[model samples]
Target: MKVKRSLIAEIKNMILQSREQAIRAVDNTRVLMYWNIGKRIFEEEQAGKERADYGSFLIRSLSEALQPEFGSGFSVRQLERYRQFFRTFPIASALRTQFSWTHYKLLLSIDNEAKREYYILEAVKSNWTARQLERQINSQLYERLLLSNDKESVLAVARGEKVPSNATEIIKDPTVLEFLGLKQKPAYYERDLEAELISHLNDFLLELGHGFSFVARQRRIHLDGDEFFVDLVCYNRLLQSFVLFEIKTHKLTHQDLGQLQMYVNYYDRFEKQEFENPTIGVLLCADKNDAVVKISLPENNRSIVASKYQLYLPTEDQLLKELKSELDKLDDIN
Candidate 1:
């Protein structure tokens, strides 16, 4: 007798679920085992306080014995990592089952306690794989956020302790577009940059920070027989407003800022509802002069912002130097 298709589908689903659950159970067990191994090594070292200077010899001896019995994973270097892991995370109860041993291993490489904690929280919140976590750390997402906000606020947002109220809180300057796969040399046009960005819309949204969804491209506006086009239009759910992006391949000017301001005003007057907040306008350019931006916008400006965009990711040293420069400027102002 043949089984019904519905029953077969149900059986397949049950098998898939069971397999997933079993995999999760095995991974959790493996993490716990590593933690226990680290804890044991730590306790044994503590008991031999007088011979602590022989820690290397101790690890080597242990590795020899364990390797012969259980195989090659317990090398001397691996034992050293286990010992350091225990030192880094002393409380076993604090370990999160959601993350695998690889995640913890990657996080252990980060020296800053606060920064490491922030990455852990963000990784969980975003449901990022280990690779994603590594990329974010390498990209200095934490430091970039700190560029626009205080350290406390950035950490608070990552930990879900606070929510951002304005676009500036989440939006980053010098937005990275390395994922677009565009050539840096030969000089690309504004239309080419826009096309590349649209082609990689998902990456663009991710780089744009949270809560943004694409709405329109080259959005057209008509006024008294005159027609104009905005490069990109998006909506920010958290801010409850439309966001207009004007891309420029060259340095930003007063004219660019003025055009964006006009677009923002147009959306605020016509497209926005009474319940929605004011529309935000972002001028994405290859370069921007702070003095020009300040002179173009009103002293109390909050809606329009000018930000530079990079076709490639800056090196770690480059980003750190820029960060230090910004901090020094803030200090001088204070």
Candidate 2:
């Protein structure tokens, strides 16, 4: 009797499935092999009494010996990294299946246990790549969280027990723009800033905090036969809305608020989907007029916000002062 066509297809699928299983098994084994290598290297370094110097010497010798035999993947620095990897994450089972060695390498740079755990949890939860994880770390995601939330809330986010409650949880005040490579001078064109932001788009998005994805730059909008351009447009995945931005080098003005409000309204009416949250307009200016900003929009306004940008990260004292100010505001009811 001849085999049915379906049986042939089934047999082919079985072969493919076995091949896939073998590939996965090999990959897992390789990961385990590296883990063991790191463990052994760490132990040997400990045995030598001077752990750091011993580890450094061990890696150098191993690289010199292995590089000739094994062409690549045996650099002294990489060997040290593997050793540090084991030291940083001692629990083998805790390693995420989705993360590569590169992710671990970036994570090791974080010295604080809570901060490191936060990045690991978020990276695994959000499925962030190595590059994304690095960007967030560099942008001081942990510091921002610490500034805005209590210890318990920060821990909850790190342990993946709770998501950020609102935009404010994930967002940071005083966005940093040092990566744009712009001079901290008096005169700069809107296009110049736009061009630099585009050039350093990744860093900008990272500094913007979680969930922002670039949508458009210099987005042109027509209003009652008058043409205007919004400096930058981005969509926040977490908020599920468009974030309209207006860039200004000088102090934020009432006119800037009006223009941003118009852009937000246009997006809410025309561009945004019905399911999306209301468009959020952010005025990024060098200086902010708090009184002017407060009165420019309605008291019930939820769609517009004004944020000041800084060329550099603030000092610890300055950050502490800002954090205290924000916390104090929560107490002012009258």
Candidate 3:
């Protein structure tokens, strides 16, 4: 965790001194080596910069020279990757010490410049490790966050310049539950899904976006001597409201949305303070029709939502299709 580092050459000598510390030392050495390699390669490439054949020739010669001593990590392809890393990140001084090469490597895959910058800044702001950053990328967090909020609003929320007033601003529809360790099946009960969410509260919070704090499970209420149990309760600091979640393992229906809406109304009427916003309700179901969900609520409704929960992360094609569909809807509205 310490940025205090040694020369990469010192590894060969220290490898013999401490067998136990070798792995940790090598990890630190590897991170430093990535920046050093990238900076050197970029400098060399710029000095003799030319067309493809020349660039290829330079990298290949460098690889052959370093491969004899450093192994496959210095192969031509990897060397090129390091060079690109330096090009993308530019200055090593501006880099986060906590970010390992793994994080930068992931960032390189993102093509959109604003999207890439968002991930980089968010990773540092949230103190995400490489693995956590990868998960967020894989989950397409940036795009999902934009579903309820605009690009400027998303950045504003990140920068503390705005407060989100809607459920979709912070809640992801079709939320991924790969961490719940559940197999996709028709027979899983609502209780089973709720249990998995409770067991994996931390991962669920990440999936739920930001400012979510778990409040209660199977929350009880009374209406005209009829008892109703809410599946889960949470509070969002940014929204300044209580969020009620209803788990539905089956395909979502208007009735399901209506039921969750009642819970939101209950919380707002009985539990919320005058300064707090209205309560939000999320019907986390396995499947839903967007049209049905839309028509089930008031014309200006922003609190009640029926969000389908996925058992696994969506593939790139699926995410693209979803984005295109959203854009089409926006075009229609405009």
Best by lDDT: 1
Backbone clash pairs for candidate 2 read none
Which digits, one per residue and each the tens of the lDDT, describe model 2 over residues 94-130? Answer: 7777776677778887788877888888787667878
* Decoy 2 TM-score against native: 0.67
Task: Return the lDDT, model 1, position 201.
Answer: 95
Ranking by TM-score: 1, 3, 2
**Model 3 compared with the native: what TM-score?**
0.87
Model 3 misplaced regions, further than 4 Å: 1-32
Worst 10 residues of 2 by lDDT: 164-173
Name the regions of candidate 1 deviating beyond 4 angstroms. Answer: 1-18, 68-72
lDDT of all predictions, in order shown? Answer: 0.85, 0.78, 0.84
Instruction: RMSD for all candidates, in order, please.
Output: 2.6, 7.3, 7.1
Best by TM-score: 1
Candidate 2 Cα deviation (angstroms), residue 262 = 2.4
- What lDDT is reached at residue 8 by model 1? 95
